[model samples]
Target: MTSPYPPSTSISPSDMAAGAKKPTDLPQAQIDAIIRTKRKAREPKACYPCHARKVKCDRNLPCDGCVKRDHADLCSYERPSKKRAQAFESPAGASTSSAAEPTEYYSYDDIPSRVKPENTHPGPDHLGVGGRVSIARDEWDNVRSRLKEMETTISSLRMGLERAEESPAVGPDSGSVQSAEGASRSKGNSPEREGIHAANTFGKGTVHLGSRSVMAYILNNKSGSDQLQALLEGGILPKLGLDNESATYPFVDLWSSDMSSFDISAVCSALPADGQCRQFFYYYRDISGAIYPVIEDITKFENDLELLLAKRLEAGGVYREDGDQAQTPFGTSIAYLGLLYAVLASGCQSSDLGSKERELTSQVYVCCSYQCLRMTNFLSQPTIEAIQTLLVIGNVLSYNMNPGISYVLLGMTLRMGLALGLHVESSRFSVEERYRRRHTWWSMAWQDSHFSLSYDRPSTTAVSQPNIAYREGSQPGDFSYFETLCKVISLALEVVRIRMLSPNAHITFSSFQEYQERIRQIMIEAKPYLRDPQYCSSSTEHLERVVLKLHSSYFCSELCRPSLKPSAGRADANTVAMRKDCVSNLVTTVDAYIELHNISYHAARSWIALQRAISSAFLLAVVEEAKSDSHVLTALRRLEGIIAQRASSERAYDNGDVATSNITSSDQGMASYDPVTGATNPRGLSHPLSMLPLLRDLAPNLKLNGPNL
Candidate 1:
């Protein structure tokens, strides 16, 4: 192309001698390139909004500065047109005269869009040995997209398969799946589902009382379901001469305004006489205390009790004006009274008194204790004493067949302990104080773990906190049973976390074996404290050993029981061995519980002991091979006989003629007894014996000749 500009009017002599080209003497292409480079260099890279506002721009499609300024719609990077370049070249009127009308400015929307380049080297669509087939870029892209979609589908299916493998499938024989499908179909037929309506009513939510709970486990078994259904349909209670209405006991209304009225005189009057109080305190110390050991200083507690009673006597059983001043620390505090009363109630409950007297006395004291606790505002200002009272109350309730209440109360108690900083070790505290805190914290944790395991619920107390080093006893060589119990419970809680709370969804056989080995090691380490003659010399120590032994076996059996489930599938040699071991441990647990009961009826009255026994008995009854075992039959019969005798004694007492009742049992001298509490009907067997019917059905050959009650 020809040059568009004229030559320069002047040139340097040095440039001419060196033969370098002048700017005005260059070719048209070189001149145009120089103009384009200068134009490009001066052009703005930022959007017009950012450039006009004089702010830094990210230079994105919609520059950040423009977006922040709310002018993203006008954020254009368009530069001035070539008209400006032409005007620059012809600064005089020569070019301006030709376009003298007006200058026109183009908006961003007026700018034409750039055209995309075509693919000149599109690859072959298919490759072959002989030749290849050429295709468009769009066709290759389409093929890639389909392959990506298929890959995604395959990945989703693989994940679903893995999840299905982790969860147990419902067997065809089990109607649960069919029932669920039927329920879904029924719901689909509802009018509410046909259209979207502004409904005011809310649907009821389903409650999942844990699938692993003992009751749920039994209900899941086919035979157990049939037996329980038959009993329900046949009106077992009516046949046993018990009214359905009589079975339900009215719960004590703690929230009532009447219960809110706290009377110091009433509490003092409700308490047993001095000697009787001493006896009851001793009972708690020997029975519940031996197991939990929440009370750090028994002597100090007794001294405080004496002071409280003496002050009450001096005040003539009324609130003394100077009582708070006289007993600055313990005696005057409402929490202390609650603690004392709770201990007394626990003792009274464990006593050999007649069922009526025991229940009445314990209820009175329990009410007094609760009133005192309410008055103290324990929820807001929980103390060591208040927590102690709750623990005792929970212990009493657990044995009284109120495990649900106990579980809830224990959860509250654990939270209270955490609030009191009992979980943390404080150097400012005295050695005795530190020990008390440790004992209280671990006691709550141990109880919480047991209840959570029994209920198949998550524990409120986690093992990760506190970070406090556990001492077996405050003093050396003490051989604390509470410590042993805590250790075992801690190990069991670990297994629960792995098996239930783990992300893996299911426990493998190898993992189960690993947990079993860990439990075995813990038991081995605890054997010395459990079996040493020095520790087991006293009666309390002996009882502790027996209870510990029972719990140890129960935990072992529980670890194995899941393996025996129908979901566990066919049994290998190892599984068979584990089943045998489970049966053996269950038998041992039952035997130990029977022995514990024989030694001290109060000791065996614990809900945990009863639960373990019942669970083991039912498991034995369910296993085909175990049903025919003579030893199992003998133990179950003995347990049944004891339950029947207690029920008959209770019936006789209800008749209001205890002396005239024809009771030929060996313990006939003892008053009418009810080992389990909270019976539906006072004249019938307690809830614990409701499972006996199932046992009877399973072991028909064995003579469990106990009455229906």
Candidate 2:
């Protein structure tokens, strides 16, 4: 059979059936058909070298390419089979085009693009279905892991504190059975003992308790145990088996900042040059200062800035004719730099730049601030500056559509506040220091409460301590209004946690009315400032007042939300009137956002503002479905207009279309938050917080923006 052909190319029965025949017995056409069949069968899966080079594959387990390249061991033909591809099909429905294609033949880039899923872009609601499912699974794993770690850390810390407690007092009278307080008091007459006790007891300065007995004595004297119990019972913190001795004081070591984790040199190198930093700082001072006045003593802050600039210049951060220094000295306190970076980050976000560009700019500064904070060991040291920096970081996160992580950062700030004794109103620190502490405490509370509401979680920063009245001639510049706004928002948050989250919970109308009155008083106090032209002489003042009013209006909307809920049975006339009033409040709230956007479109797009806008729009859309109102329609259109503007700006920026006309062009690209009926959320079937199962296969075009949504 192989008489005329080479022995290696002998035609077997299978080859004969495939049209192969002995060369002497076959026509040229039949021989050519056989050769083509052999060539097609010889196509190889890529060998390692060929794959690495991105050259054509021969499809052989060990193709001639691999044999010639001496890479037989690196050759592979294994890939997902047809059955495996079929398994990837979702239960809802397989993507028909995708399903018909062979898995092994397709590259990831070969997949055709599809339409974007609803609500997955153009705004914060960008957790596409596939992304949401993946993030849920990942966050679930992380939460469980963190919980376990917290449990272990808490248990270990408690044991250490307890063993320290069991040890006898470490002073003059050895093993005397005097109470911890009596012992501490006896030793406190000494100058050094008194200072340590004062600092630890009132959170004045450094809490340097060398012995457990001293710590126990101080804690007991201050009734620290009772405070811990109150915090746990009030649900201000997770029930983490906390001992008062451990809870009230910073562990000084546990969860302490890791210095090595920070790379200051890298952060500095990544930062925009010194000139850009100054520009951002000025912008922050002028604009963001009206909202968050973190840096109180501007003069002292500038002195600190000089030191940072010198260090940066020395580090080759500045381009000067004199040339850069080979070695740069490390600044004493990275905390100051952290604050500066955060301020710049905030300023960049609020800038009149393209969204993508602004985000990138802001992100760089945020990372820089975060790095500086970590390098300075901020967790162990609770300075006003450090707390302020944390607050800024939280705000930045929320602004970037990341509320969950922001909430975690805020929690850390709260814990730091506790460690610093901001909760106690003692005269241990200077009057200025005391004022800073008070403001910082309230700021933390506001952030905690607001973020909790956004995430539908319980408020964690409880304000159970007696309020410290702001002393006359002591309030920082323009801080009074900011403080007042925070106070009002904090009160509204209590309503949020109690009513909106747990609507069925029992509460008397009298208490509710009392809460309402508190809000009313705040609004009344701020009314003159908001309404009086004399009070708001400048644009900043006017804008601040507008922000204050907007928040108050939003608060009123939230306060009336519960009453607007459908009743189980027929509602009375009073109930019906209350519902109508609720609708009116919602309309007013929407109007407030519209008004804010008109006043400052840049400011209106801030995280809190955008959240309020989305919330009101969603509510109005729902209400409109049941009862049509002209006001509701107007509000909806206005909200849509703002969203459209944002979409247009973002699209123009992304497409490199930076002309003013392009940005101003009308856009219909607003993402939807189409409300789901009942208690379900729009995205997933699972509880809003829980991670839902993912689809087996992601459509080719779906993009996921992960947990930020």
Candidate 3:
């Protein structure tokens, strides 16, 4: 071999046995070039999509997996970069050694120059590779992190389950285990004592006692309980279904109806003529406005209405006094429209329009008001005007025999008022502004308290500081009526709060008696001012007096209702006497309600007054049936007579007999009206012996004799 080959290419016996030269003996540039070539040759065999998804491929131009996935166009292979490969190779002496053994091929890691000593596995950017491998690495790290988190969560849940299994089972008498555990943790106190402590703590936050409702008390009585169950089972009472249609207004799906079709022009055209509008406004100002006093500036409101009407005539579309475009959705103009329509609706209800006309016209205005409010997105962007509009709408709905809907609207209005900081007194504002805010917030509180009592639900309106001030002198202004009303309602709410205390707590009979005394004291203080000859001159003043009396009597009876239940333990002589007094208060309450209906046209159609009257009568009937007292029976009969008369009048109105149905004074001595001041003649209205048929059905001893019966 030495004789045939050149001296430079000579192969010795040792070199032949070794098969190849060592990689360390080679040049660095040559080693890098070889590693690059090996990596290029290790390219994926499948198409790019298949490789990325890690799926099997047939190695076709458009692989079967890619075709199935509807991505055949993206099935081309990714070729190794020639420029990257060339950058690593030295221009000269970069050729491969043919004598180099095939088994000694270099891998990427074997190239010492490509990797740093500190980091054996460099990033893809450092390695000059494609993004596919980098993405796969990142996803793998994410999966590992998620698995660790799941393991931690599972361990925590397992520990909780083990603890739960070791705990004692709960029982009705012992209360919930969590409650027991919470009680036991409190500094060595017994579970029962701790339970009472916890309940008392919870009761401090509650504003109403749902369990102390009149219906609940009646059901607590054995006789009334059985009769009520039987009546409900026999379907004697109307089914209380949650449907849209009602006797007062037809069902209109304002929530789902197409709002794009709303026409401002059509809404304007539907408004009452200017003269009629003024008449309706005056009617509301004298009746509902006199009571609530929510609108502080009547002159400003009237001027705004006139300006709105003028602008509507000039613009031929939605008009904003603030120069906002008609196309703006949540503009002041839309909210103003809602407010105006709501006022008009309430006024219409208070007006002496025929029964059908009142319902139909008020219904139209209400729907329009709702549409405008929705268009303005009042929930997200509440304003003072929007709150006022909602208050009026709630009042209108409450009287329209829709108290449930009215309550829901009142809740929304409360939230809106809170959002505008109306519930809080701010010294930063002007005196006028502060008074206006106080007026609105107190009105909401008044409405909310009454509604809460009516429905036996919790009130959302919390009493805040800086109470509305009463005038100092004996002479009473318009504010005097509202202030007195608020005082009475506040006392009633306090009674409700006390009743919410836990049964296990140590509440004394003296506490309830104290509340009853407070209610009486407020009524006494109000009587002198309320009966002032100068103050009681207007129909509004007279109406206020009657309403104040109704609330006082009803709430006084409410404070004594619990003692009537047998489950309340044996009653002492004081409790027995209190029960008799409660019955008398119920009679007075019902009578005052009847007088309210007689004096005011608005009260005649008010569902709130009607509901209060009926509930009081029912409670009276329940007590009379339980005790079989002749005095209670006589009081029940008188209430029944008044209700029967009102029901008959409503039926006549429904039948379109306005002449006979119109509440007026007559020689026959029906409900007498004072036409001059719009109040009832105190001497004319009388309660003849009668009975409600429903009450008779509920209590068999009740004798039915009225025309309604």
Q: Highest TM-score: which candidate? A: 1
- Per-residue alpha-carbon lDDT of candidate 3 for residues 52-117, written as tens digits (9 for 90 to 100): 455566776776566545567777665323333445767675556422313322222232122212
Better of 2 and 3 by lDDT: 3
Clashing pairs in 1: 247-680, 247-681
Highest lDDT against the true fold, candidate:
1
lDDT of 1 by residue, 266-364 (tens): 555566667788778877777767766777777888788888778767666555435444422224676787888889888876665655676667767
**Counting only residues 3 or more apart in sequence or on different chains, how many pairs clash (N, Cα, C under 3 Å) in candidate 2?**
6
Off by over 4 Å in 3: 1-209, 233-256, 260-262, 298-334, 463-466, 469-479, 499-508, 524-529, 532-535, 569-571, 625-635, 658-693
The better candidate by TM-score, 1 or 2, is 1
RMSD of 3: 23.8
Model 1 misplaced stretches (Cα beyond 4 Å): 1-208, 229-261, 323-330, 426-428, 463-478, 503-529, 532-535, 652-709
For residue 649, what is the lDDT in candidate 3? Answer: 59
Residue 243 displacement in candidate 3 (angstroms): 10
TM-scores, all candidates, are 0.64, 0.53, 0.61
In candidate 2, what residue range of length 10 has the lowest lDDT sum?
687-696
Q: Give Cα distance to truth, residue 699, candidate 1, Å.
A: 4.2
Q: Each candidate's root-mean-square deviation in Å?
A: 19.4, 34.0, 23.8
